[model samples]
Target chain A: MSIPARTTEVIGILGGMGPAATADFYAKLVSITPGASDQDHLRTVIWSDPTIPDRTEALLGKGPDPTPWLLDGGRVLREAGATVIAIPCNTAHAFVPRIADHVGLPIVHMIGEVARYLTSLSPRIHTVGLLATAGTVRAGLYQEWLGRSGIHLVLPDNASQDHEVMTAIRKVKAGTRDDTTTALLTRAARRLTARGAQAVIAGCTEIPLGLSADAVDVPLVDPALILARALVSRAGADRTAR
Target chain B: MSIPARTTEVIGILGGMGPAATADFYAKLVSITPGASDQDHLRTVIWSDPTIPDRTEALLGKGPDPTPWLLDGGRVLREAGATVIAIPCNTAHAFVPRIADHVGLPIVHMIGEVARYLTSLSPRIHTVGLLATAGTVRAGLYQEWLGRSGIHLVLPDNASQDHEVMTAIRKVKAGTRDDTTTALLTRAARRLTARGAQAVIAGCTEIPLGLSADAVDVPLVDPALILARALVSRAGADRTAR
Candidate 1:
C-alpha cells in the first residue's frame, strides 16, 4: 500500500528438525512477546523444512550431515528479509557453527542463551541435569556451554540414554504425549536428581512437550523457552536501537 | 548435501493478521498431519507480518486498504519458494480477491473449505451460525460461500455482534484467553442455536483460542482447523500427482 517503513527486526526461524517442536517454539515466542495486540508483536518468518535430515543421526556418524540443509535454510531466510535467525532445535545447534558463517545473518544461539540464563538465576544453580537426544549429549553442547559458567552438568546413563531419553523423544516426534512419555522423562529426571542435580534442563525441544516442571523435584529449565525469551528481548533491543 | 528429493508441495502461510492466530493455525496443521515423524510433515513458509494494517478497518471503510500489504506478503512467500498460500485470518479473506491474482500462488480458500466441510458432515447441516470479525461478516464471506450449498447462515444481531463477538475477538488478539472471553463467545453461540442453527462456525481464527466445541450445544466448527486439513490433503494430492 503505502511506502513501507523499515521493520526494526524480522525474526527468522530455521526450524522443523521436528515440526511439532518448531510450532511450539513459535507459539512460545508469540506468547512471551510483551504485546497486547497483533500489531504489537514481532515480524516472524518460519521456514519449516521437515525434510532436513535427522541431526542426531548425523552427529552419531550413522547418517548424512545436516550442515548443507541448515545452510540452505539459512539462505532461504536471509533472502526472505530476515534480519536475525533463531534455530529452535537443540541437537541442531551442533551444526550451527558449520553453517553460521554462510547464513549471512546472525543466529541467536539457543544453548548459549541458556547458559547466560542460568548464570542470571536469582538462586545460583550448580549441578543441572539434562534430558536430551543422544546427538546433543554426544556433541557436548550443554557441557561446553554450561562448563564455561562453572555449572556442573549431569546426564543420563548409557542405558537410560538409549531407552528412556531417546525413546521419549521418539514418542514425542510420533505425536504422542501420554503419561508413559511423562513417566519415561520423569524416571530419567529422578535419576539425575538423585545424583544431586538442583535443576533439570529439557535440553531437547521435545523433552518439554511430555514433561513439566512439577513432575521433577528440581525446577525444569526449558532451553526452548529460554530461546523464545532471548528472541523477544533481541526483537525489543533491535526496535530501540533502530 | 544430497539433492532435496523434489518437494511434493510447499505450503505458504500468508498470515500475521494477528501473531497468535497464525501460530495456532500452524500448530493445528502439525497436529492433524498423519505423519509420525518430522519428515512426514509438509514443507511450510510462514510470513507473519503483524504490521499488516487492520483488515476489519479496511472493510469498514475507516482504515487504509490492506491489499498492498497482502500482496507484499504473498510476494515474500512466493520468493521464498512457496507453491500455495494459506491465510489464517478470516477477515483477511475479504481482500483475497484484490491480491489473489497478483500473489502468483494458489491461495487455498479457507471459507470455501469450511463450507465444503460442513456439507460433508454425516448428519448434514442445514443451518449454521457464524462467529467472526465484523469485517468477515460485512464482507459476507460465509454468507456467499455457504449460500451456494443451499445452507442457511444465521448471524449475531448488531448488538450481540458488537458487544459479544467483536469484543471476544479483540480480547484474544490482546493475548487474553480467559473465562470471560469464553463467556462472551458462549453467549453469542447460545443465541444462534436458539434461532435453529445446527452448528456454529468459529469462523475467526482467534475464536478457537477462547471457545472450544463443547462450550456450545452445537458443534463449534473451526475454519482454521478445517483449513489445516485441507492444506494437508492438498499436500498429499500433490505428492501423488508428482
Candidate 2:
C-alpha cells in the first residue's frame, strides 16, 4: 500500500456529555469544513464517553466531579496523536481548564469562540443574550468570556431561567422538540431581545437542536457552530505550523 | 487520576467518503445504542478522511484507487486500540476485504447487515430493491452477499439509475436535500416497487438523508441504521467475550 503524506491536524474531541450533542457538534464540524473529497476534512478522533458525569449537575454540586472522565477522554485523544482538543458541550468547558492542564493540549475554547464570533458580526453585536443550562448560567461561562471582551450578556431572569430555558433544554435532551418547547424558547429569546439584546447565543449544545435563527428575531448564534469553525481554523493553523 | 477498567470495545470507523454520511452514521450509532450515561455508549474512534479517493469513481475505473487511504485509516483505528472497524460508506465497502487483510481487524459488514435486517423483518422480505451509487451496483456487493442468502435483488432501470439515484446521491453529498431531489428519489423507489420489489434498501449512505420509511410505500431499510446496530452488537459482544 502506498503511504500518502499526512498534512492535516488531528482534532481530539472530549465529548459525550450528551451523545446527541456530541453528534451534533461533529456534524457541524463536517458541514463547516471546506473539503471536496474524503481526505480534505480534518482528521478527527472523538472519545465520546457519554459516561462523563453530567457537567451541569457537577457545576451545581448536584453530581460527581466530571474532571476524571474529562481527563480520561483527553488522554485518549492526546495518545491518539490529537494536536489540539475541543469540547463540544458548553457546560463541559467549566472543567476544560483542568482537563487542559492534565493533557497539556491546546483546547479550542467554545465560549471564547462564541465571544469572538459575536464580535465578528457585521454590526459588531455587543448586547447578546444567552440561553443556556442553569449550570452554565450559574457558572457564568459566557458572561466571563464576553465580559472580558466588553460585550454585555443579557440573561433570562431567574424565573424565566428555571421555567423556560431549563425546561426547553431538558425537552431537547429527552428528544422532544415539539412546538411547546420551540414557543417557550422563542418567548425567552424575545424577552432577551426586549432587554436590548441583539442576538441570542444558544449556549447549551442541545438548545440549537430546537431553536434556530428563524425562531428568534435576531441571529441565533450557535456555540457548537462557532466552536466547529474555531476547530477548523486551529487544525489548519497547526498544519501550517508543522 | 484513577484508572478505570477498560471493558468496552472501541469501534474504529473508516469513514469520510462524504463527510455528512460519516456524521450521519456516527449519529445513528449513538442513537441506536442503549445507554443511560456517557460510559454506557460504546467507545468509538472515527478516522474521517474525506480525502480518500472517490470510491464510486475508482469502482467505475474513472478515478484513483482508495485502497491506500482505506488501509491508512484502518491502521489509525487499529493503533488506537479499536478491536473492530466499520466503514460508513456503502461504496467504500468494496475495499473492505483488502483493508481487513491489511489491518487484521474485524469489520462489521454494512451490506451484510442490511441483508440480515431484511431477513429479520416480519413476513420475511424476499424481493429487495437497491438504490445505490453506480459503484455499489456495478461491483455487485449486494448481489454477491444476498445471492448466498437466497434473497432476490431488484435494481432501478439504467435511466433511473443515472438520472434519479445518482442525482439524489450527489445532492446529498453537496449538502443539499431539497424537494426536487426528494421527489426524484421517491419516484425511483416507486419504479423499483412496481418492478416487484417488496422493500427498498436505501443502499447508499446519502439515500436515507432525503428518503425515509414514510417517503416510500414499501419499507425503506437504511443500511446505515443496520450497520450501526451491527456495530453496537459487535462492540457489546466483544466486551462480553473479554
The best candidate by lDDT is 1
Isolated chain B TM-score per model? 0.95, 0.94
lDDT of 1 by residue, A1-242 (tens): 24253347889999997989999999998888766677788888999988889999999999888888788889889998899999999999999889988899999999999999999997999999999999999999999999999999999999999999999999999887789999999999999999999999999999999998899988999998988888878776323321
Which digits, one per residue and each the tens of the lDDT, describe model 2 over residues B66-150?
Answer: 9988888887788866788889899988888777778888888998888777777788777889999999999999998888788
lDDT of 2 at A173: 68
Per-residue lDDT of B13 in model 2: 80
Candidate No. with top TM-score: 1
**Regions of model 2 farther than 4 Å from truth:** A1-7, A234-242, B1-7, B35-40, B101-104, B233-242
Best model per DockQ: 1
A37 in model 2: Cα distance from truth in Å? Answer: 3.9
TM-score of chain A of 1: 0.95
The 10 consecutive residues of candidate 2 chain A with the worst lDDT sum are: A233-242
